[model samples]
Target: MSDAEKTVPESADAAAPESAPERQAPRTLTVRVHRCGPGGANARFDDFRLPVRPEDSVLDVLDRIRVETDPTLVYRHSCHHSSCGTCAMRINGRERLACITRMLALGTDVVTLEPLRALPLLGDLMVDMRPMFAHIGDDWGYVRPVEKASTGVPHGVARYTRLENCIECGACMSACPVSSGTDDMPPPEARRGGHEAPAQAAPGADVADAPQERMFMGPAPLAALNRELARHPEQREALLHIGKGPQGEKHCRRHLACSRACPSGVYPAKDIMDIRMMHGGGKD
Candidate 1:
């Protein structure tokens, strides 16, 4: 053999560095997205395989699945960041902001995305927030603003400030089991109408406009009421009157799931505990 032909082809490793084992292709993430489309049977999970990078967000994977893979995958999302909370959903059995949940944090090749449980599913991953926020209003809703603007800082300013953090995203509602399934539960809109329902009945009446007055209130609105009650001690008696009955604090099962699912850390479980204290005559 010639000198060039006898060179042994550089031993394959010395010439090309062994090709680096094909670099593994960055891993494709498989997401099982629960979908409930119009006239669909019950709810079903649609599997989507997406190639994901380490820095990709859950929302990114979902979007890719929607656009590139399955156009039928339905979900709600506005801000790609965590500011909107519109993309909040249950990822891997935990409520999270899809925009902020990095793919690497899940530590799994398969990520399951579902709507916040309990609330009515609007479509694929969208759950109705109206009922959840309405749950709060059912328990005395908002302060009546005693005197337009009293106490130098405004009468209901402190109460409003604290409750304003609520994004009304239904994270707390999704976590609450009582309000989601049980009948005879009053939604928050029953207390404060026009925004959610626009035709809810008066606070104490079983008005024909809204039948939700008899249903149990969920955690989100109750949490807001708890914040309001924390501000105005005098409102406790009235709040208790509104918060009583099957639709009130009695519905909560002490699950503490509201606290766990809250993307903003509002702590609906703690709020419900405070409501219980007030109901028990701790303060008002």
Candidate 2:
């Protein structure tokens, strides 16, 4: 072979520039779930360690755990999106839609999961939403008329309509102070002189003589009632009657927790307050 015609292979170090970048290591996370069997049996916390990406949501973690680590892990999810609201649960002690809550964004190495409160526990990370629906009577319609001019409706259509804001996820009911109990409730005296006490207190009633056991229909139902009234003004008399009842808007302490917990921007607390105003409950 002539010196000029000699064949040579490229060295590994010389070819390193053309090589693909090294793959980054996946992040490790600990998922802590509040588990319970049917009828609330074997209640305990189950921690699952898994490698996950930053974009993975809490629902994704749960799916991986159930598929790979534990097939017996029970939970509810549908649509894999926030529209269904079926995957709503308490994430890190706050009400959230698991399908949309990114685990890494929570800024915690360990993610805590629990079923919503004030509803019957169906199992791990699942609650019975029937009670909330029962309060929100079936008479109310879910769709409401929207202005056709802005919606660009077809010429044949009479009007455009849209779904009501409430997704009925029961997050409001879970966060409601009234629905949960009065154990953590602040005294009437402590609650006075703030936005918390919107309704007027009776004369000479500075402190609660006794912890009044008020029966509340809850924030979700009252918000639904407000929507019902807006859709059908003819039903005002009947709906207002319901709002003024013992288990209606009158019982709400105006904690406003429901407004903060709602993922769909329903602002249930404001709805309850509006009903109270319609009932002649003066503004604070």
Candidate 3:
């Protein structure tokens, strides 16, 4: 009613902090899935629009598509929990377990899904783990099992619980520059992950003998690290030598991608550092 009152109201509105506009949440999210024909051939992409649900996981949307839209769709998931290491794939350019990867947290309206790189692609989002597993050899050579009673963590052995632990998810390998173009790559049947290599490469490794340059066995070696630490004292030195040898730590590019992509917090880079520090590496 008064000019002074009107001016005061206008000044208050001008001085107030503009509440940062709340972002409008999407009602539906777009999922662009890399579809593979049987045996993971003829790779292609298909888009699916699904209703966004509260705390929706990437796996949740995929399950909905499989159950309601197309029964032919295939993917792998043993325990929907992160423990199984079954539902890992390239989601939005990062290798992560679908079960635990929240769709909303990605902060993107559209999410892209594809099989992990570096392993033989089986189909859709599935890759072969058998080839990778075969390298371990039959004698895991951990602590030899006793017929009578088995023991837990060995005394005086520093637990990898902090520095290095592996769940065999292969996500680290997927992100590693050293895990590609193996000189003696196992046959497809032996491996079932995507053949597409990651974008990065080790220094001087992008050219000829790309596979040969990779010294360590890549991120999967952490699993073997777990086992070796459990082996008898006599066997420990040999294992440490392998880590410091060619096809081991000497090839690491220090990219840090594998360590970052890991969902299990394995700290593979730290593991490499620990081995190098312990062995005082030298000429092979």
Candidate 4:
């Protein structure tokens, strides 16, 4: 062969750089989204397989399912970055906020998304949080006009200032046995059926209209109560009023799941203990 042809063989290594190994496309994940139409109609688990990026969150997958896969898949979320806990749901049986929960971190090929337990499932992953805060009256939910707001944490005092850390994500409420929806969880043998709302509207009672008095006061409200109790020690009698009620602290079995379910570390279970102690209902 000619010199040019011979040079071609030698030039190959110098002329061409090795191509990078082709980046594999993100693997598809099976998103098992529980679906319940408006008013809890046609409830069921609709599984959709979609390519998931490593950084994609559970909320991201749900959004994708809504936009790209199923338009009717209903769910609720707010401040999709974790500031608002509106996106809290059951992921792989644990209560968590969908926005911050990374899909890959789930460690399973199929990620199950269920509504937070212990609440009325409005639709799909959406549960009525209204009842969670029902016990905390408007005045109780907020710090009333203070002669002086806390300047800062007093020296050497472990004040319960992390109250603000509670985004009221409802995870604690979902985990609580007394949260009203815990009993509705389908047995493992039963498997997926459709939408299982914990407290189905009674014959004459509307789920929305059900009396808060009859509802089990969830940890969310108790956490709010803790804030009020911390600020106003004189309201001990008012706190006792709730403690003795049928749906009040008396209903809690001390499951302690509330603290585990809390994404922000609010640990409403501990707050419950404190409230009970002050009311003379809990032990020392």
Best by lDDT: 2
**RMSD each, Å:** 13.6, 11.0, 14.0, 12.2
Q: Per-model C-alpha lDDT, please?
A: 0.67, 0.77, 0.68, 0.71
Model 3 C-alpha lDDT per residue in residues 10-108, reported as the tens digit of each score: 577677887756655646888999989655579899999988665678898899899999887778888887877888899998999999988888888
What tens digits encode model 2's per-residue C-alpha lDDT throughout 81-192? Answer: 7787788899998999988998889999888999887677779988888767777778789998784456566888788778877888888887876665532555466532
Backbone clashes in model 1: 15
Q: Could you estimate the TM-score for every candidate?
A: 0.65, 0.78, 0.67, 0.71
lDDT of 3 at 111: 93
Worst 10 residues of 1 by lDDT: 191-200
Model 1 per-residue lDDT tens digits across residues 1-284: 48857766556666865554433346787888887864333778878776787778988888877788778777888978665668878889777889889986799888998887555667888876666565455544343434344336745455322235566677766555555442334554333212133232344332223456655567876777777776677877766665554466655667677788887767888887777765433223
Q: Which regions in candidate 1 have their CA more than 4 angstroms from the true location? A: 1-25, 39-42, 138-163, 180-214, 231-234, 279-284
Please give the distance, in angstroms, between residue 149's alpha carbon in candidate 4 and its true position after superposition.
13
